[model samples]
Target: MAATNFVRGSVLKCSFPYVDRPSRPGPHPHYCLFVDSFEIRDRIYYAVCYGTSRLDEPLLENHNGAIFSVDSSLIKGSPMSMRVTHFVCSHVAVIPDRWVYRNFQARLDFIRPEGRKGDRLRERMYDQFVLLEPLMEYEALIAVNYVRKTGRPGLPGETTLR
Candidate 1:
């Protein structure tokens, strides 16, 4: 695959392999936020925090200082919309560039708001991935801090492309 550049704060849709259910037929599709990227021995790697809509049950208790929620309104051009989407900062994953290029679906982009200089920014749009409005500067800062404090590095699921 050719070299592709992804910016921080970009939201990506990827096929995330199930960590607990290796017997499952295939990987499950999921939305994740692009946080950081680096190159190791000429191979690129991405660090992302996966987002989930399961606000109740087992995942609910996981929402504490490290989780942040994005409302549907903040997300545009998605085929489907959940009432709210939560990203788990502690559930960080570092995946190979090959896997990311192969299983990639869509990504989020920023849209600048119109009107006066002080006017709030408008919702953003993207081509394939769900178009998500960029998080406010403060929100991004909080997320970064949380991820830095709690993020555990690992490829928690299948690492190779099947």
Candidate 2:
């Protein structure tokens, strides 16, 4: 997908050189939600945060990473068979302008709203993470809805959505 068309809820499989392993010598698959995207001069940038299955882990000392505890109810009716329950919202990443189109995979299934619980989570995630600019409430809601709503039954296609 083109960087110009990236949306808030898209789940992407990106290569992270930051994660290192003693036995592995290559980039690992870092799944993240496309929270925001913008163009600056000649390049386009995306703000993405890490998602994890370890809900027990702390936010840690990283100011760029924040983790949200998700539950089985959120994934039960969804399409992507993800095992994760927590999303690390503090670990915000700026997708390189060049790799936007190359690494994008598909949009996963999402859930609807869970009222105050969802609202509080969104507020907390946004407040803790440093963004290039202020994230609009609507935009945040869109991303949250994408994660909370059980919309479809398969990985979204490569076509640009929203």
Best by TM-score: 1
Q: Can you tell me which runs of candidate 1 are displaced by over 4 Å?
A: 1-4, 21-26, 76-83, 101-162
Query: How many times do residue backbones clash in model 1?
Result: 3
Every model's Cα RMSD, please?
8.8, 12.6
lDDT of each: 0.48, 0.42
Write the residue-wise lDDT of candidate 1 on 1-162 in tens digits. Answer: 214576645566654434453223126556777666654456555666667887554454543344555555555444434666776554555555544534344333233233113423323222112322233232334433433443422344332211
lDDT tens per residue, model 2, 1-96: 236565544565554224322112125455566666644344455555555554432344342333444443333222344555444554444444
Q: Give the TM-score of candidate 1.
A: 0.55
User: How many clashes in each candidate?
Assistant: 3, 16
In angstroms, give how far residue 79 of model 1 lies from its true place.
Answer: 4.0
User: Residue 99: error of model 1 in Å?
Assistant: 3.0
Quote model 2's TM-score: 0.47
Q: What is the lDDT of candidate 2?
A: 0.42
The TM-scores of all predictions, comma-separated, are 0.55, 0.47
Candidate 1, residue 157: Cα displacement in angstroms equals 10
